[model samples]
Target: MIWEVFRQEKEGEYHTHCGNVHAPDREMAKQFAAIQHGRRKPTNNMWVVPKEEVGEVDGEKYSFGGTTDKSYRWATGYNVTADDASEVVESSDEQEDAERRRSEVV
Candidate 1:
């Protein structure tokens, strides 16, 4: 059986998929994943999941945030005057920058 390995380099960090291993069971899979994926990196944690148990969601087939208009949730959408508040102005600027970058990619 094939097992997918996810490695975390540090505590409080997200586990990202590193590679795969071939093993008959979960325990052996974990061992194989450690030897194959963990040794090359500064691994803080590892997760071995059976390949058959894994699932995927294609972005082309599904809308992850649903088909609702969520512009109201964005900092750019609010018509507030951030005259004296530096943090709010900074957040709005960041949001606008991100929106511009995403639009360029699309």
Candidate 2:
């Protein structure tokens, strides 16, 4: 069986697909993933799943984003004073960056 591996570089970060391994069972797949992908890398977490269980749909079969200009729902649309809390500040910064990037793409 083939197993897909995903790795999280740090805490509170997203897990990205790393690589795959061929194993007989889930337990062995986990062990192989830990050694093959997580041994030298600065990985905080890892996930190994059977490749057959993963599914994907082509863009022709799915219309992902809606056809609405929903700029009002974004944080950049409002002019609120900044908060002193670190987490709130981080979130605001991320949202602002995303909005900026989206505007550039559009």
Candidate 3:
């Protein structure tokens, strides 16, 4: 059977399960997974289990929370501070003009 493997990079980030591989046994599963999931340079780790082992929750059937006057209760989700609005100003006018001159010379 074919089993899917997934790896999570950081907190609040979704796990990206790359692909599926079929194997007749656990040793074969690991071998196939090592090639499929481990061959990449950035492969951190993976969850290798049988196809029948994993449980799934469907999107429609999954309940986030009950519907009610949720604004005050779930206010944390909507809160954003002014510091979040700050943008990264990487380059300035002088740097841009210098780069333009170098590009023109090239």
| Candidate number of the best TM-score | 2
TM-scores, one per candidate: 0.59, 0.60, 0.51
Write the residue-wise lDDT of candidate 2 on 1-106 in tens digits: 9999999999999999999999999899999999999987899999898998888988899888788888899977776664545688899899999999999999
Candidate 1 vs candidate 3: the TM-score winner is 1
Q: Model 1, stretches more than 4 Å misplaced?
A: 65-106
lDDT of 1 by residue, 77-103 (tens): 777765757887899899999999999
* Lowest lDDT block of 10, candidate 1: 77-86
RMSD per candidate (Å) reads 12.1, 13.8, 8.3
Clash pairs detected, candidate 1: none
Q: What total of clashing residue pairs does each candidate reach?
A: 0, 0, 0
Give the clashing residue pairs of candidate 2, or none. Answer: none
lDDT of each: 0.92, 0.92, 0.72
lDDT of candidate 1 at residue 60, scale 0 to 100: 89
Q: Which stretches of candidate 3 lie over 4 Å from their true place?
A: 8-15, 65-106
- Where's the lowest-lDDT run of ten residues in candidate 3? 82-91
